[model samples]
Target: MTAPVDIERARFNMIEQQIRPWDVLDLDVLGLLNEVKREEFVPPAHKALAFVDMEIPLLPDTDEALKNGHCMLPPKVEARLLQDLAPKAHEKVLEVGAGSGYMAALLASRAQRVITLELHPELARMARENLQQAGIRNVEVREADGSKGLAAEGPFDAILLSGSVHEVPQALLQQLKVGGRLAAIVGDLPVMRATFVTRTGEAGWETRQPWDIAAPRLAGFPEASRFHF
Candidate 1:
């Protein structure tokens, strides 16, 4: 018989090898990685792959999962994003693409509150259930199109797009409070950049590209028009 997987050691290796080297050196962020049981947030069928350096599908193995864009971000990507955003205890965060609610859980642990939106009905339900099961109360999971941003809950302190987009939507940018920051992976496949935008004024914004990272395309956003000529 095969020996059981060493859960704690795997978690350690994941942090030291995959996350730390990626410049996710924030002590608070690293500590949160240990405090939260990533294995529990993962789907049972994928529990063994939780700490691996790949995206874990939120749903069980199925073609529908691919079509629905339902998969958690890779460990290093998630950790790095969290460190960049650095949500504060007094801030309210908006997270687009609530894949399995793991990212929301991480944001909620730092921010005062987190509102995560998922487009797929089933995925939204799963996120809610997973967050509840993990006893994460500061997060509110909504079943809605995240591409447009939640105007009703406008003026968030920080916003995060959990997947890749050809460009950041203006609607989402308009939802940020002045002085607030928004992070997203922008540009098409094979060349996506981790773009960060800060709302500097009522109608002003400053943008920065700190690094490059590829992620699955998030559904619901409008695709850019292409020229045939």
Candidate 2:
């Protein structure tokens, strides 16, 4: 068993080696990566690998990965994407995956309000508890499909997905307030680029490739609904 002290040092090393070279330049983000105790959110059985470069399984291993909802993104990729979002104080944010509520907790430190949607009910509950334990009140963890996105309480200032998608969901794009940004890894396995799409104006969305990454595709997202399919 890796001692908590060792695990923390490894996390710092992971940030210096994997994230800094990836061009994540924000000092606050780099500091948060080291400050947040990721192992606290990971299942006890797998806590030892929290700082390792491999994905940590959050759900039971299943024949179909999409159905299992088990994969937690590597620490470096998670930190870099969070840095890209650059959440502002008091901004209403929407996050598509709650994973372990770790990402939402990070966003909570920077944003005013965060509504994080998680497809798995267990994960959602776990996220809620973790957020409370961490004393972060700015985030709301709910059980919902990321693809369907959040309805009713939207028009978000910034939206982020903790998983990948083959393409951006139009409904999600519609949910973003003008000038709001959305980030997700969009592409096939073994190779995918983290993409950031910003709503330039009411009718314009400009896409930019922020970084190269590999993340599991979010479950429940439909195939592009015909036009963009």
Error of 2 at 28 (Å): 0.4
Model 1, TM vs. native: 0.95
Q: lDDT tens string, model 2, 49-112?
A: 8778877877656335434545678887887888887789969999998988888988888899
TM-score of each: 0.95, 0.90
* Pairs of residues clashing in candidate 1: none
Return model 1's CA RMSD, one decimal: 2.6
lDDT of 2 at 29: 90
Candidate no. 2 TM-score: 0.90
Off by over 4 Å in 1: 1-5, 61-64
The candidate scoring highest on TM-score is 1
Please give, for residues 1-229, the per-residue lDDT of candidate 1 as tens digits: 4324698899999999999999999999999999877887888888889899987778766566755568988999999999998899999999999988899999999999999999988889988998999899999999999999999998999999998888999999999999999999999867999999999999999999989988888999877888676
Report each candidate's C-alpha RMSD, comma-separated, in the order given: 2.6, 3.1
Indicate the residue-level lDDT of 207 in model 2.
95
